[model samples]
Target chain A: MDTRPDSGHVLSADRPGRFGPYGGRYVPEALIAALDELDREYAAAKQDPAFTAELDHLLTTYTGRPTPITEAARFGAEAAGGARVLLKREDLNHTGSHKINNVLGQALLTKRIGKPRVIAETGAGQHGVATATAAALMGLECVIYMGEEDTRRQALNVARMRLLGATVVPVTTGSRTLKDAINEALRDWVTNVATTNYVFGTVAGPHPFPTLVRDLQRIIGVEARQQVLDLTGKLPDAVAACVGGGSNAIGIFHAFIDDPEVALYGFEAGGDGVATGRHAATITAGSPGVLHGARSYLLQDEMGQTIESHSISAGLDYPGVGPEHAWLKDSGRATYEPVDDADAMEAFRLLCRTEGIIPAIESSHALAGARRLGERLGPEATILVNLSGRGDKDVDTAATWFGLMDDSESEGGR
Target chain B: MTTSVAFEKARAEGRAALVGYLPAGYPSVDGSIEAIRAMVEAGVDVVEVGLPYSDPLIDGPVIQTAVDAALRAGTTTKDVLRVVEAVAATGAPAVVMSYWNPLDRYGAAAFARDLAAAGGSGVITPDLTPDADDTWIPAAREHGLDTVFLVAPSSTEERIAMTTAACRGFVYATSVMGVTGTREQVGDAAAGLVARTKATTQLPVAVGLGVSNAAQAAEIAAYADGVVVGSAFVRRLLEAPDPAAGVTAVAELAADLAGGVRTR
Candidate 1:
């Protein structure tokens, strides 16, 4: 509905919620007081320049804001087919991913709200690590919920979070994955609403979260949009990124939502292929349903039970997506497509070999999609790709996938 | 000697009633409909089918599992309505219990209207305040649906009175200090809350949280006019190897639990 600020939908202490059809405080009765407190605090915090300045200072000084917009020269020749391609270097952010943007903002907000405990759920553990990093920086008690399966697969990330002084709780129930971990985290929030703030990692879930995360991440788009405008003399033809829960994609897409001239493309993980019944292309293959706390496209059976989704990249493996993406897909302002594991991996190798930039497996999906789109566009067309996170944490997995590390070397923890 | 309709009629005979708890479809969708149906059939008085979202920081394990399953099953507001409609088709009085996002997403006024048309008798949004009820409650009332609110033991006596007046249904009296489905015994504390609430308003006060088995249900029923057993019924459905059988089995337990609480 009226999502614009002029429409009187702008957030206020009185209306600290209401994000079009996207945001509001959807919580348990027990936490109503806490939510009201947070709402009051966040509204004031939003108005406080000191809060904004402190966050801005940290984002710039600590998380390394204004990350480079590097043009993929050699990789552009191959993937871009001689077209201009630039990458917003969020990988250079502290903790090696764009997840730092939202975490830092939420941590600051948590403090302002006087909540001492921070809880989050992670899949690939990138968000967990970033949250742990923020919690350590803010000196907040952090509890991270991870799927039992993800903890084992992303052991380095697990270790990294522990190193940051965050307690990692392995969720063994349900699918034992990101969705389940989120469920567990919600349980904890419901149990400890007074002292805890749930720091969601994506631009999804019920109202305020999707909007909040996007606002926090909007820096990526704000910076990238400005960088592209300054560098290319105009906005790029398309802004493309991968969509697991649509954080980075929304991060880069939000600033350009009203910019009709700029096309936004979100690439989802297609494990083998969408046709192979092994993929996480929820926006494409899924029908309108609900999952993970919001109404959105879901990969569900006839009875509306969520079906298991698969992807080689652990981060991209989920059955549902953020509701705004569903709106964007329906409205056709943005388009979501899929890139298979083999294609993403191929792009990963090509980017590394040509540009010396090893992209995260999740980001590689966007790179792969950009490569396909760039070929169709003329050389005059410029495309901006949100390089959502770094690949350093993925080296071990990449090494195994590319057969770079020997068995013994691969066995050693990075 | 008594039925859900009779109990519901009896409650309306005096004034509105309130029932609240986290349900299975809230975090998951598979057993959500069954849970709502079972609660309704068992004479829940008014069903709060929690549409599970990601950041439910206030629910206990049973409710958490329900939310998890709702999320995993990809349950959303539309699905919640679909479930509600299915249960409403049974002519059961119900409420679409959820966080504000779904109501906002579906358009609060339209959602309330649709819920009423679908036979939803009321709403129990713990997050929505009386002052802000202008956002959706007007529309909710326009749709022939009541606005149910919550009052906890920790709530001030003034808050109890204000919320009771704001509420169209009974005041949802929390039996314990924590989220839904945490206590083994509701103890004297819940009974004391019920007495305090009764002193303030004539509205029905249904006690939930930790009231699972028949004995516990009967225990709480001794003081309060109505009793809500959520996690126990949800756990029955979830732990059941077969979902349909789980539905039937949970319905039976609800039958037993409701029977224990029913005043003949």
Candidate 2:
């Protein structure tokens, strides 16, 4: 009966069903049995020392944890107005993003739960690529749904996922994008309820998902918080991260939510501009509604139907925010702002030029927000920006956007 | 009399009926009301007033957009119920088609009583089953409203029998394997499903999903007692932009489909 001796590390015995004000089982009746099974398995796995040791080995050898908290001295000097800037350097993580942390944990959990097939929905394809990588390493059958448009734009990532032995399904419904991919994935899950474990990529979805992903990803904040404090002698004036379903933001901000001295800001993508009816600023312009299995801030019509959302960054190009992020916005625990495509692109280029760090276009939204906050805080404020991912994956898009590639030439090759 | 008694009579008389669907206040609340009025005037046997939720998983693009417009227009469950009451005042048979959460939130039993009192004849929770039927069905029957059940082509023989036994007004047979509002033609597959459902139950089996036009409706009516066309009507409403005109247009279409029914 006591099968889960390995789960002691992740879930605290004191608070077995909570993650701050977030996380709980808020799904439908049909998923109750599967969720209960998962909860039990997860509990047992945390208590298993062997499971912990193996996971630790993967974190060290595979994911490259204790990722450097590098001082972006030159970039910081300019951004600080005199204050220092510290990068959590999650960009250095394998697969070049913090997305791997959650993917690896879930892949391990998938095996523990005895599920042979893993499914995920991808927008920017970072999470898809990460999930595909984990599945190939563990040899689980993997299926990833990407928007048809994203499949084309992020072709290399599609190839990457295929190379990792995952089936890449191009979702061609609704907007033929991320939201539709989510719809298709949910339908797949409902159909394959008995045989599959959906490796949800971010801190979103119904109940346990937002909690599960945060717990898996908390390592980033746990390490970064300590690393930053040790290096700076105090908490930074502000913490900034981009909001694509708010995973990385929550990962970093959860540790500092109770820190009264630190201000947390989440940057949303304002595509062309908020007024142009094009943007993914759900927290800023949306209301609470059920989407992708959870009640969250969603861009929707009054009848509760999902509305078309736009964002220059493909990862942030979704119509709904994670449920906890909605709660945070409603409760005023965090402030969210929209950074337009132009500003984010400028910041993307600026960071590359000044710090030699090419961040994902999604991460550049955070950098754009940091620049504004830096101006407001004025020379006396230190900001810890979560350089959440590297930009190699986005190079082709960046090249075209910046006109670095010839208009007539096909520019996908590395 | 119970709504189920009416369905039994309809089935016995060998007279297939029509059930029209419209989002509450789609073009506008008034437009939706006019559509219902037209449906009643146009001889619709039943009207399914949809309580729009944000994400309708089983719906195609057209109905989804209609729902979006309705929600944008500030339509709520309470507002939809008011629309139901308004339609009921016209003496048209009304059924509320909705997801379970809103019904659960409103207290299923309480909702049943209020809806029955307000002139609604039936309740169709699209996602519920007989085993899980206790959540709303008993309360609905207690309040004198019929609790309809749905069966798809994928339903097992055992499931069809179970659903037929538990069903009240009529059994709704989803003709296709996909969502509502799809333009995929309703083929012989739907006809086959209707025949199968008929074998399982003495109750009238109404075919929905992919029954977009009068031709499809006539085709479906050949096998089933009735055909449910949601997206086609919603599409008309979407195009006309005026709710009354949209309803009249759909009512005309419904009449055309009803005219095509041929009994053996």
Candidate 3:
């Protein structure tokens, strides 16, 4: 496992699959060979033009690639000095998020490896929907493990996945949330490794996964960078995106890493606030520890028991961030900020009213962050934000939060 | 006593070792200690005191529930050390089975020192790899503690060699390509992995991950130097109506497994 120094996505030089000391294959022995095989397949795939061409074809024709970049004029005016704000419309992609980018690539890889079934763990169900979509297109059987709590919160996603012919298993073990879902998914993968592949949703997990997912999603930044340059004639002062397991943010940030002048900002979910001890701002309020197969910043007690993360958005309600983000934060390449639920909801509402775009609550964290960042940089600066997902799935939750939907009405809506 | 010493003693008996697992502070801290003592009295050769983690990814529902209960009961690393110390007092070699985070947070050097001082034999880190053992290995060795690493059916020969080279006490051979839980039958992959691992190192190879009843124990012990059971013991405790019943059930199962290994 030598470092691919010339490979655009290989960030760490000496360590092949690490971000500083954060990322490594910390899984059980059973999955090591599978991971190695995946790594080999991925490395070969990167070199094969046919693989890239087919992926590109699918991306453009099936997933609507080069998703548009829009200038948020009305949203920018609300800033302190009216800064120019731009949105990378990943929400416009098929399946309504940047998750499709990674899912499609992994689905293709699964086919290459001759695996017949794919399993994944989902939090908000966006990844599950995207995986199901890709599996359907590839004619592969799909099984998605979601926490019971998340299944209830995002019932529409469950139905959508079922309709797409993917079996959704509601995990009922340990807190019954995203972490639990991941545990179940890993168990499933270990048990069924001979015939199945685990389509990891985010830029977390073991070695090759963090790198692979980032590489697949890197198309977002590669496209956005060229599109931003063509539209603005220059790179923006700062690029911001919300961080949960940090796939979308890492996807967009990787392209801008070489540009020294462009700042990277990662906004994490702050349910109440970091100080209140109820948020998912791992980098802001947590210490480095291991969770879900990677050593990263995790919300854990002194005894290293993971703390339950709270957020209105299920996508960001995870106690750990991707290891790369942890490396970026420590290496002074990126800055992470926390946006509380109230501010994010306000940002969500503002985006809906001003830009006629309903951004997911997960994406709203970045919007909230950009607004504050704009005030600091003032009118002269430009900001690029990744609108990670569409808010159609979040309308019911939003209505309930804004008191527009009564409890009874919400129950009936579900 | 070191884990190696326990294995040597078991080898002298011309039988494989029976290793039992119980999460520290499960049911209660004192109750967990009592259960391990009972297991040892019932002829268990080694005791693995689990340090409950919030995210037990390598565990199935049974061990997850037991570990979750231990966490809910406020099990700390300190409590785990206390349990290990008590288990060790039973003259059964005790090892702490944990994910790497708690030991990392507790300070690897200090954890090794504390465990060594508590008379614990070693550690079984499910998630930590040999490549990532730069910190834990030296610290454990400095404290005269054994370092046990896992080798699976999926491991390459090179990986098996590397893992066995890093292990001091024994190589934990996962009986199946799955998390910790009971299975009706042991996976066919176990024998081959144990043979491969044995070729890499002279260290005794123990098979675990799915061994439950005496039949499975005998099946694994036929090829492995030790038979490690976790979820099955946890299942007994989980299904028990009371704490005393849990201890009785665990001891009875341990005796059965012990007899199976001896017969093998």
Candidate 4:
């Protein structure tokens, strides 16, 4: 109970349902009961030692938690004149991403809440695959809503979820991406709320979701903080993570919030580039508005309609970030920057060639930002980057982008 | 042309008021205005002009399709206000029913000022609860506009009390615990919900979300002060051969529902 990132509840939101004018229960009346029930269950479960113990058991034994931090020596040599680079290997988790942390916790809560089924929305498919894996483990009927475009881009992940016995519904509305997938999932939740629990993918949406998901995933930082101190006898100079809905970034940044000496950086997906009018750099380019139950910085036009965001990485291709991130951005606790696609891909290749690690495109953005930070802060300052997911799901996209795939190997041309 | 006047007229006629809904820019901005005009002429008492948003979480497939089409066709808040202005000019009360973002982005005070200037009544926010409302209520109070909130079958007595008290025009009691769409039968819990809402407030209570047909309207009318219909009117537009035919179809359905509200 004392392990919360809220610094003994001193830094938590002054009230529930919001983080300084960011999050609220903006959903319809139909979902109020379910959300209230979930809020009560999660609050009680979080305080119960038995619940935390069971979660810790599953995380340690099943998810292979306490995921290690590896110093990317060869990769670090290319930037900051030989600065140390530590990569948090969340890519090595059970479902190949940090998403499993939240999924497993929510799946357990689903059973405790007595819901027979669970539903989720995903982009890039990492969350969907993790949700399916947890549902399979927990014997819950899983349904995942994915953007039609994402389903095409992340075909391998689609296959992974189906193999895990989860139903995948491709959302085709409004830009056909993560935002649309969330809309479809909310619709499904509104319809089947009596028997189904919505296993929200990231640190966003209505109240409790942002806090709940962040609490579940923050163990990454909790473990890594001690590990880094043990290895180097000091905290790293900067902590970096890729932010889509900001689950992973928040996971790594929460532990460092109290450590003022450690700077926190979040790399957003910049497709084409921010100036090119094609990017998912929401916090960097967006104005404050409500979308998907949270009032956060969003890319919108003059008319308040949500503008579609572009990103090479499916997981990072969202128009919104977590409300807590919005609060952090305003409060000056964390700095966010846009990492262009070319830079991310280059970092992805660098990690592959130097460290023999294939980083997910989403995580590559953080790697790219870390390399840039190294260039600025010099070789003496250490940079810790969150390798949020593995590159297996993005192999097809990487191959196409790099022109590595033979025409014969390429099927279903994008 | 205000909501109170519309309700008063309906009470004088010894009938339940008919509140009809259509998202502006559906069909087309001009086409929706024409269709809503037809509905008013055919005896719809209140016109709830929907502000078509990009992400409508509470709307079911039919309205979603219409909203998507409207946004694709470049519907704006300006167009929505224009629709409200046109509908209010018809001597039938008009109000905006939106998902909160468009108005929030446009500035809450400015929106209330403009809506009141357009002779519109207020806002019916399905996603906005009175408890979370700070910007809109103050703005609406300044502009003398109603901020209608909803109560559901699942609403606790405490919540119903809070929601109904915050409500100005009327308390919108959703007949069912789902998004906006048609259902084969009105929810069995509707009467209980209305009665519970009535016990808490002196405000007129209107029932909505699935009362698509005359029979359902008449049934709801027996207990509720007003009957709100949406999807059935939209279904006519979708099922019609052309825009003109759609208007005619919408008029027919509105007339039927209006007759059903007579209850005598």
Candidate 5:
């Protein structure tokens, strides 16, 4: 029977891992037992003080959690309608991104499941690098799947993952990008489930993943909330983050779902523009369909073939969005908008010049959206943006875009 | 005329039914039809016309390569139905095995109606589960088409029972814990999974995935009601020098598999 809409499945009630009509196990039956075991493990992990203490110790000593919030005064006054913009400095964390938050949790869960190896699929390789790092830390065997095209485009991250002692398999099937990488990773998981854990990187996959990753990454908002209060004496008027598969956005937004006054804005990658039909603006331009694992908004053709998504930011170039964002958008708890490649680059350059903080291009979408939201909410509003990662991984793309790198350097002929 | 009729006739002969799968428009829409026709003529009891999808996560490299070729050749939902129509014209029970999206995109009710009108028997969803589904069951039910759901080796007793209850034509036991590919040996878990599935429902239980040879087919047929072979047939076409050769190769393989089922 079709039940009524899920009333905030995560914090409100113990849902069957559903967010309204979105998010369910739309996977093959083979993984159901594993998913159930993961669900049970995560639930128990949440209650067990030993697990929590160990995770907390890792977060503090190893991951350097409870990251600080910096006020972007110069960038705010110049670009954002003079609104107070506060940046949640997830960039400064050990792996240089908020991805470490969830990766560490799943790596721990992988160990708890008694599986000694982990496999992960990556788009731009942020999650892949993070997963590789955690696997190395835990002394577990790790394998990373990246699309062939992406492996060439993101060679440095490939190097990083390799340096961390993970095998990098270049997937040649399908579009040979993030989508195909995920497909290959799922195939690997199905074959090696008895010994390996598919360390899902985002909140977009089936069942417990959307819920599980969110629960692990929610510390972004959980910590941001208290940190913002301790600094500002009151909650911010709004929260903003970039949405690809929407792990970081969902991570930052979960703690704010109950705060009705705080408007949540997710910035989708508008490659050229949504109107031009070349963008990854799933929530803005997509119809609800199944992709990856969960039923969510996706770029699909009339016959349901997944249309390739485009974005200058490789991390944000995904056809399907997290199911929670779909639910949040439909339920009117959040608003999603597209930021064109040019606008995001403009913001990317602006943040580096004004705040001396180079943000991930994926996070640049959120920064660009905040400027728009600041204009809408006016100067009186306080906006907290989750700078999900540092820009070190994105320097090459940024250098080429801004013409900072000459042709010879980019071409590698010199 | 239907899966039940075909399967029952095979059962009456004291042999497990041979099920063959070939994706629509693999070489071309017409060439795909020819391959399945060869399969049926060579003694494949049931024809499973695969509807190629953009994201085929349940498939291995062999099927994925074939599906990609089909998509590149402009295989559409309509072409898949056309293939089904051609296979059914042979008086063989034909079913379209597809992922959920294309059918969902074509409108589940509409696709079901189109398939029924096409003289098709049912759909076999590799991804969609009975519990996860909302629209497909009703649409298939309305069109008098069977909804075949898979029961994996890792499926719990509760899930197996629920999956079988929601299934109509026959249950697809995924035999292995992984996607579609021919393994060196059939997983030992297949027989136990089939026996467990049989205890729950009277519907014939067909074993799919990793069955590459007649020996493997015979092994599965010893316990299963039907032996489903896909990648092996697709691999022949993938490696064929010519379309006609692919059809002949598929026919040869199908005949060999058919023999294996009977001997068992």
Candidate 6:
């Protein structure tokens, strides 16, 4: 049973939700019926023109769809042979990130399923903000579980979610991080399955979720493919996005999978460095294991205990990546590279200084990877980078990292 | 004795079997074995020796805390088998309850062979369902080991049939829709799930998850072939200040549960 679909572009096939033995519903029995219902409703919703039209209308009118692509001439000057860098401006979207794309679609599905309450887990708070925003618009009660440690670091997003009337629960369980938050959220979903929907943030989790989130996010590449052609007169030489749970990268990669010439690259967070054993580069430096519902590349010890992953960017600080990314890696359709925290920060600073665009630290890993890739491909090459989000929510952490704000000021502000 | 034999004997005695759970190496590896042996002596028909895993997703906070302590104390699969071998020597059936990852990592076929050799009766895999047991079920069957799968309150009738068909020694009917924990009241859904599972298979239906006190055990015993309790036992040992006291606490609780299961 090699369950990998023949076409990489297809979301799923008849193989029961597996992406070549990687993705499957590895959840408790309590969630199976809910996941099956979601699978059935999603299959129906895909065929319904009314559902498609409503989603399109919401994406266009509310989310500001077809975000523009900017050519980064100054940023590309440092390339070995003056390559061209094109930026897909997902940062310009509502909620300042590509997370809104998946949230809106799942929120619609949540409403269609008549679930009045939605629960989500957050690491960096971007997904929580987006989920809260959609829940507010739809008048659904939203509960966002965040680790106690993340709440302290990402305090601003907590306030933003609360402002949107989303309850923020600080999880104090195992390791007090993203994984724990997901555990708590799963528990909540199991307990309140009748009234609530779990809005998984990434292209991970059980069956339909990996496929569904990717379909929602494919708009990034769908819009970027045309935008790049309209700007460059042809397709770019490569497409790149950062991979935490790999939602944004898969979103952009799906549309370009059939474009043989356009190479796909995913940048994983290399916290200190893979050599130092303090990184979230799951695909680059991990083995296949199950975590957070899906069997993907995971950072686990020999005893099958999940190891804590470290990254300067909380969004990329996850132990497991999406199963699709693992499939793509094995198929040789996509190249995954590790970008260290220092390198990503350098690229983050360079983008701000040269192009006046502040990228989310999560996205900066891709920028750093793009720079290295561009230098290899030379001047005639065009590379498109998915700039996943703005840096506004991360300013306090960034200021502290760069020593831009005094310790007293940072402490007092929080 | 085999798990089936233990259940048969309990049926002959006109009582629902009392299954007790204790994570190996919680306070220490030897200490846990002693505690479980005491439970068997106190009249537990079946003992489920928990192999501690780092991510026990199906478990509640109490079991999670105990399992965490077990893992921190350096419990491994080898250590787990040692505890099972010792517990099985007590003339009661001893089954290993574990999440699937550790067994997968340890190699499923090898685990089956090792457990059977160690005199362990079977396994209760909380996370591995019927659909996902392609490798494990076949391997367990080859080694003559009992394979227990869980059916939950949320499970549809079709799913209940599918799960019970795949089960061997017994069908574990999760009493609630949530993770493993003790509640003041047994979920009303437990009886319906037990009935549904019973309709599907002749295998004994054991109700677990949230059965804490003797009264709840007695209520479940009226319908189910077995009453399984995990978190309550873990809580008893966890609140104990020392291993000697923990063993006494587990023995006392097991005696009470044993009394509750005697329907005749």
Q: Candidate 4, residue B15: CA error in Å? A: 2.3
lDDT of 6 by residue, A1-414 (tens): 011233544334546768887888777788899999999988888878888888888888999987999989989986314789999999999999999999988899999999999999999999999999999999999999998988998899999999999999998877788888888898889888999999999998888789888888988988899999887799999998999999999988888898889999999999999999999999999998888777789998887788888998989988889999999998899999999998898888888888999999999999999999888998888999999999998888778777777645542221
RMSD of each: 6.6, 7.6, 2.8, 2.2, 3.3, 3.1
Poorest lDDT segment (10 consecutive residues) of candidate 1 chain B = B15-24
Off by over 4 Å in 1: A1-26, A403-414, B1-171, B177-179, B185-202, B213-223, B232-264
Q: Provide all candidates' interface root-mean-square deviations.
A: 5.7, 5.9, 1.0, 1.3, 0.8, 1.2
TM-score of 4: 0.97
Model 2, span A189-287: residue lDDT tens: 655656788888887776567777777777777788898889878988898999988889988887777786888899999988988878999888887
Q: Name the regions of candidate 2 deviating beyond 4 angstroms.
A: A1-29, A406-414, B1-54, B59-92, B99-264
What TM-score do all the candidates reach, one by one? Answer: 0.76, 0.72, 0.97, 0.97, 0.96, 0.97
DockQ of 5: 0.86
Q: Write the per-residue lDDT of candidate 3 for residues B35-58, one digit (tens) a residue.
A: 889889998898999998888888
Second chain TM-score for model 3: 0.99
How many clashes (backbone N, Cα, C below 3 Å) per candidate?
A: 30, 19, 0, 0, 0, 0
How would you encode candidate 3's per-residue C-alpha lDDT over A1-414 as one tens digit per residue? 111233444356665578887887778878888988899999998888888888989999988988999999999997425889999999999999999999999999999999999999999999999999999999999999999999999999999999999999999987788988998999899889999999999999988999999888888888889998999899999999999999999989988888889999999999998889989999999999888888889999988888999998999999998999999999898999999999999889889888999999999999999999988999898899999999999988988887776545432221
Alpha carbon lDDT of residue B25, candidate 3? 89
DockQ of model 4 vs. true complex: 0.73
Runs in model 4 with CA error above 4 Å? A8-14, A79-81, A407-414
B224-246: candidate 5 lDDT, tens digit per residue:
99999999999999999999999
State candidate 6's DockQ.
0.70
Candidate 5 lDDT, A115-227, residue by residue in tens? 99999999889999999999999999999999998888788999999999999999998778899999999998877888989999999999889888887888899899999
Total backbone collisions, model 6 = 0
Best by DockQ: 5
Go through the candidates in order and give each one's C-alpha lDDT.
Answer: 0.75, 0.77, 0.90, 0.90, 0.91, 0.89
Write down the lDDT that model 1 would get.
0.75
**Candidate 1 lDDT over residue span A1-414, tens digit each:** 001232232233444444334334444445556555655676677778899889889988998778989999887787677778999999899998899999988899898888899999999899999999999998999999999988987889999999999999998876678877887887787667768998999977655677777778888888888899898899999989999999999889988887889999999999989999889999999886546555578786654556777887878888888877877887788999999998988888888888999898999999998898889886777889998887876777788777767656442132
DockQ of each: 0.23, 0.13, 0.82, 0.73, 0.86, 0.70
Q: What order do candidates take by lDDT, descending? A: 5, 4, 3, 6, 2, 1
